[model samples]
Target chain A: MYKGIAASRGIGIGSICRIIEHDLTFEARQITDTAAEKQRFREAVEAFVQETTAMAADIRKRIGPKEAEILEGHIVMIMDPSMSGEMEKMIDAGQCAETALTAVCDMFYGMFSSMNDDMMRQRASDIADVKVSVLKKLLGIEDVDISKVAPGTVLVCRDLTPSMTSQIVGGNVAGIITEIGGKTSHSAILARALEIPAVLSVPGIVDAVKDKDTAVIDGTEGEVYINPEGDILARFVLKREEFIRKQAELNSFIGKETLTADGQKVELFCNIGTPKDARKALECDGEGIGLFRSEFLFMDNTRLPSEDEQYEAYREAAQIMGGKTVIIRTLDIGGDKDIPYLKMQKEDNPFLGYRAVRYCLGNPDIYKTQLKAILRASAHGHVKIMIPLVTTVDEVRGVKSLVEELKKELDAEGKAYDKNIQVGCMIETASASLIADLLAKEADFFSIGTNDLTQYTMSVDRGNPNVAYLYSAFQPAVLRSIKNIIECANKAHIPVGMCGEAAADPLMIPLLMAFGLDEYSVNPVLVLTARCIISKWTRAEACELSDRILAMDTEAEIVAALKIAAKE
Target chain B: MVSKKMTIKNEQGMHMRPASLLSQKATAFTCSVKINYSGNSYDCKSIMFLMAACIKCGSDIELVCDGPDEEKALNDISEFIESGMGD
Candidate 1:
């Protein structure tokens, strides 16, 4: 078994078909007829453009327009005057077309590779790709037609390029193994977009595998088996079937409302960090935006984002959500997230020090800018303000007062806004959980941030490896706190949502349902899976399991019980 | 030469798409379009040069256009950059 980067999730069993790179070796000689050489270079470029354009069209239809853009970029890159023109200049000086192409590509490749930005650095690889394709054209070499590969063929290559990936027929390729490339590389992105199981950056994979060799790919685990034992292959076959069956089940849950077996409906939402991610939440069939971390606008900028900038960001998300709830968590920074511009003094224990709501309330100018922006955005859709790290009732009240002040200011300025926009508290601290009823009465809603709740409740620094074992939302103490927070919210007739990793855990879903969680907000990709899990348990069954879990004394015993009762 | 200084407002500055668009638009003009970033001059008509400049969001750069249509070129390119390069 070989370990590699798991680029895409799924299991695939197939016969290997190694994609050997073509040799484009050529003899360089001085040419007296520079005109003819320049013509040769231009023709080769034209041919490259024609072929790439066709492939872009095919990929656009087969995969997506976004993936097609990678191919379409090649045409634009090669046609750039700095590219083709430079090559022609070198060719006009009596250099061979191959030499000219290599020289110009190398220059741009060096320019892009030296950049500090990751996205700009990827352009260096794009230059290399263009060089190879144009070189192949000049050398009169044929590419391996990936579209014609036999069904169930697992492709082994050094690295998958966008042009080569464009020819892939998803049904024909069962899996892909590459010698180099990471999860975010073009190879991985294309493989995932095609929905083909892929294991990338496997060392010596191309040279080790032969055509027709049987292989089993556990893409989820990033493990590959070459000509495995009969029993191992049989086990993998069953695993593959189970994965496919599970995926189909999850896909069927899309476009459906979140409901329990006994017909209790709940909100299924997604946690997003940026405005653009709202589109992904919609794509994943999320009912609303549960937690929109508003720190990206500040973290990604050198200076503090202006009020107009923050408003545009919030309005963009609200517009994309189309009236769905967008709970914007105002700047939860100064903990592990240190922005240089903020100039927050270094603290001995940052997480326990001035952070989140405490920092915001102290810095009224910054806090008011964000609050007013959010209030202005509320006019576009269902926008809510969620205060983070609220340990005291005054923190929630302070934020509410600020919102009220901002609303009055907006009214005086004759600015249109949502007057009834909800202000909520993110119950993450032990103090907040203990005084949940007070917070529930003061705040409009509650969203449990289980990560920090578990940490503060158990006095375990999740970052400390030695204490990591103690940091789990399933811990009896943490579970009880979650239960109390939910009960407090319910008793006050306010909606309570959970926007933490535990909210989507299949084992934890039933307990949350039993606790009467009004909303579950998880990663966008987990929406269907969470909805599917929620549909499996009736309230009575969940309550019985929760009762048993709540009666357990230790985390280990409760986890064991929950695991046994978990529905797959 | 006509020139104007502007900050790149696009979330991702001078990436493939923006570079391509800027270069294509610049190529249509009968002028020498160049971007002066961090004391370095980059040909705006070349996507390769524009991308290699690595001008990120919030980077203040000068757009210079020299030739018969320098005024028109500078105005158009400055407008495009100010509009976040159609991002």
Candidate 2:
């Protein structure tokens, strides 16, 4: 067994088919490179370009356009006149098909590798992708489908491109182990969306697993087994069955009310970043929309989205829920995610640096545009807008001021908005959670953003691999922070809830309930498990547990107590 | 070459981003634009050269343009800079 960054979540067993690797530097056969040979190579390259363009279109048809955009970017590079000029030069230099192809790919790869542009870096992946396709075509293996490998097969390769992975039909895949990529790469993103059990960045996968040998893979843990012992196989079978059963249970909760065993009703909302997620929210029986990250409105396009464009999207979301609560988070883009137009500098520490509401406050046009859109769409359904990364009372006042200013603009312009729309803030930073009482007095509500609160309280970045485990919302400091926000809201007569990754944890649900979390929002898939956890405990029982956990001082004691409580 | 000396007030310095923002706006004019920092000048249109200047947060830089719209360009850019990149 080995550990890897878990890209997708699941467990499976399969026979290993050590896939053919394409990582070798191209060793082109020599060519006479006469005028005829040059002409032939250019024609072949053009053909490849045309075919890839068509393939990109097909990719769009198969996957959603967002996923397919990764390929469409490549088509632009392939058609670049400068790139074609480079290839023409290579063909004139008397290089053979293989040699010319290698030279062109290497030159393009070098240029892109040195590029600071993220989009160009992503485009480079396309060059590599097409180069692989051209090579497969050259070898006469382009027609052989990977589905021929049979069921229950684990495909192992030195590396697999996004196109290569996507070509492998879903549902037939048992597991996938690769020599390259982390969670952020394109292929990994596709794999994750498909929910295939996968492990990437594994070292020496080729040397250990023999072809045709049975292997059991745990995608959740990034573990692989080769010719496992009987005991291990027994455990794998049980684990696999348990995973399936758990998924079935989560699926069973489709359109069901989220009622806990003790009948304490907690709103289970879906944390989404896209309009398409509204469908998933409805499918999961999400009672309200907890977090609708509006950054997508700013990203993936030139200039900010128009008010009507934003209204159309927001209205679509509101219409989908049939009057369900849709709590939209105003543009939270910052840190690693930034717009070139925003004129932001690289900070030594991005997560803790100026971002979110600060960026909005600095660029009032952007915020006001968003506020106008949200206000305009409020008539569509139960819409609530929340400000992110608030750390000061002044920031809360600023948001209120914007809402008022926007309202005044709307009223003068005769634009309609729900006059009674609720405004709220996310207690993401240590400063915000600490002074929750004062901010709560200003805002109508609060949602403890555990992702950042855990990071700030423990000085551990949840995204940082080195200390991600230490950044636990269940940790005493983090729990205390949540308790403080809830306690403050309770004092100020405002409601507080949690809408972070921790909100979905069954083990933490009891602890959260004890702390008086009024609402819980999680991933769409985890609605039932969280609901089940909430149902098992009463308000009084939860209040008691909250008091005890708040009184505890050490992380160890908190974890131990939660573990014992989970068992009970 | 015409120029306006200015300081970056947006917490971040007069570095790459403000330079880029200023540069992007300047290119809309039918004039050539440049920025000078600490006596070294750079082409305002080049994001690379501007970023390479290594302007830290809360630092100062100068903006210059040589074209028919240089004055208006400088004035608008100066407001963008003065307003801490604007809200």
Candidate 3:
């Protein structure tokens, strides 16, 4: 067996199977000409329609109306002009029921494929479902397991559907090779989830391999070697075993505080999106939520959420944290995030234009509504509200005024809230970093949002694919900004935290720790690594390393020196 | 024929996840279930139609069922929609 990039983890040993390119073409559809066939077709169509209706009803019962809007595409296909017209045309052409449905599905899929919006891409699946359903009826075949083929099966197809991908469970017969699919494809997702090794979009994959040839799959690296020699197989097997052991070792440390050779303590926190993520954070032994993106509340909605509703959501998260700190970033929407109901005008350059506290300043009504919710929720447990992308000190003062306004309203109504609640600002952009000392005086705390900080410092647009690689937290300017902000915060004796991906990287942990970061909030997965790094160094050693880094002219030398100086 | 009535409840009323669940469950049955609100009636499996009706958390609607498990389907479907999606 040969070694390749493992797109996913886990081992699968199986004989190679014949590769087949999946043709999505739907033919031999039955539109039904004869009276008997028409009758059957009508019954099937009606059943399909009713089935779709009941499903929508169930969805309405769970996620709510705003989210259920996605289902309208499928509903439109089944009921109105989309599917109905296709079926009628096929019937008029005197085609069979399956043939007619297939023709209609082709037309619908074509219409959706041309649309610009990505959310509409799933509309193609609707037509595919209709074609698949009609074909299933005609062939008299029950559901086929797309996740795993029959025993001794090493099936290779062009691409897998979402439903089929979800069906894939661990311990499959063997390796999978496909010609079509990308990093985000359904087959790729399944491979990642099942931890089965598979290679995707491997051009000329079919010609090189054949049935009954033993193959090795490395889904993690997206590598598949056909008919490998003994030496190669032995090497891969050893590597796979080592990876599995390391993974298990990481899991065993979950919920345990990390401490390295030395004993200097540093708080390790996790970044979160929803209350559900709180569970994962707890599992990773996070001290508390370091950066909670709270903008999800307003993302896909026609109306603003009520204070009580927001309170319950915040309370749920607080209860999950079990009284651990939860720093909730308030109204981070601006720039890329736009809510129509909030009446945010479109800008030519959204990133450099209005966003964060800028939008909140203009729309204090909406800002106060969220403030009320956060203040009300504070009664449940430790909850801190953080404002995003703050530059000038005036913005922080303005934020305080609004908080006071809400506090007065809550006070008159006799509503209970944490009286001395803390307020913080995300030091993300260059302007914010430069004035961290001044802003630190106004705000209770500061958290470094390195995702934006790095982009801004390097003069690269993070969203632009070509420039994205240039945006690195390891850059000297980025580290300088972090150093400047930390130094400023230290001058005021206020705690400073880093909550971006850089804060979570084990390789970068020593860098931030060297900058005298009091707290590190990262993806829950990185908290252990950060804690381990922090515990090993003395405050004095870190300061020297930090000074060396600040004086460096180039980023490369600083990184190399950091590696040598940091405790292993 | 079987019929039942209830108010829509789950907080994010008639949204994506709930609609998919309703549609998936509906596909399992051979019967027809239609929900009526105001003067309009929509197929229960049509997530869009249900969502188009814009039934809020407190809105009342009638669940009408006809077919193989009319009574049983009516009871189960009614309880599901009325009990606010899932407990």
Q: Across all candidates, what is each one's fraction of true contacts kept?
A: 0.81, 0.00, 0.00
DockQ-sorted candidate list, best first: 1, 3, 2
Q: DockQ of each model against the real complex?
A: 0.78, 0.04, 0.08
Backbone clash pairs for candidate 2 read A260-A535, A261-A535, A261-A536, A262-A535, A362-B87, A363-B87, A364-B87, A365-B87, B13-B57, B13-B58
Order of quality (TM-score): 1, 3, 2
Chain B TM-scores per candidate, in order, are 0.97, 0.76, 0.86
The alpha-carbon lDDT assigned to residue A367 of candidate 1 equals: 94
Q: What's the TM for model 1?
A: 0.96
- The predictions' CA RMSDs to the true structure, in order, are 1.8, 9.7, 8.7
Q: Work out how many backbone clashes candidate 2 has.
A: 10
Which lDDT value does model 1 have at A471? 92
Candidates 1 and 2, the one with greater DockQ: 1
Candidate 3's residue-wise lDDT over A1-568, tens digit each? Answer: 3343345555555676564433434466443345666666677766655655664454455433432343444555455433555565566677776666676677657765565533334445545755665455444445555445555455555555443443444455456677666665445555665556677777766777777777777666666777788987787788778767766666665666655335656778899987668887986789999888877667644567667656766877888898899998988886778877878778998888889889888888888888888898888889888999888999999998888888899999999888888998999989999889889999999999998899778989878898887788878888888889988888899889989988866557766666768788988767666665566666666666677777888767877887777564
- For each candidate, the alpha-carbon lDDT, in order, equals 0.92, 0.75, 0.70
**A1-568 in candidate 2: lDDT tens per residue?**
7666677788878888887764445566556645776666566666666766675676677666656666654444444434455666776777666566666776766665576755445546666776666655444444335657788878887666766665666667788888777777777777776667888878888777788888888889888877899999899999999998878866666666766567766678889887778888886778888999888767744466778778867877887878899999999877679877666888898887779999899889888888889999998899998999999999989988999989998999998889988999999888998788889889888888888788888998667698887977778777878878888998888878789999988678877777667889889877777776676778777677767877888877887887777722
lDDT: which candidate is best? 1
Candidate 1 lDDT by residue in tens digits, A1-568 = 9999999999999999999998877888787899988888888988999999999998889888889888899899998888898888888888888998998999888888887878877788888899999999999999989899999999999989888888888799999999988888888899888888999989999989899999899889999999999999999999999999999999899899999999999999999998889999999999999999998899988898889888988999999999899999998998899989999999999999989999999999999999999999999999999999999999988999999999999999999899899999999999999999999989999999999999999999989999899998989999999999999999999999999999999999999999999999999999999999999999999999999999999999998998899888
Worst 10 residues of 1 chain B by lDDT: B5-14
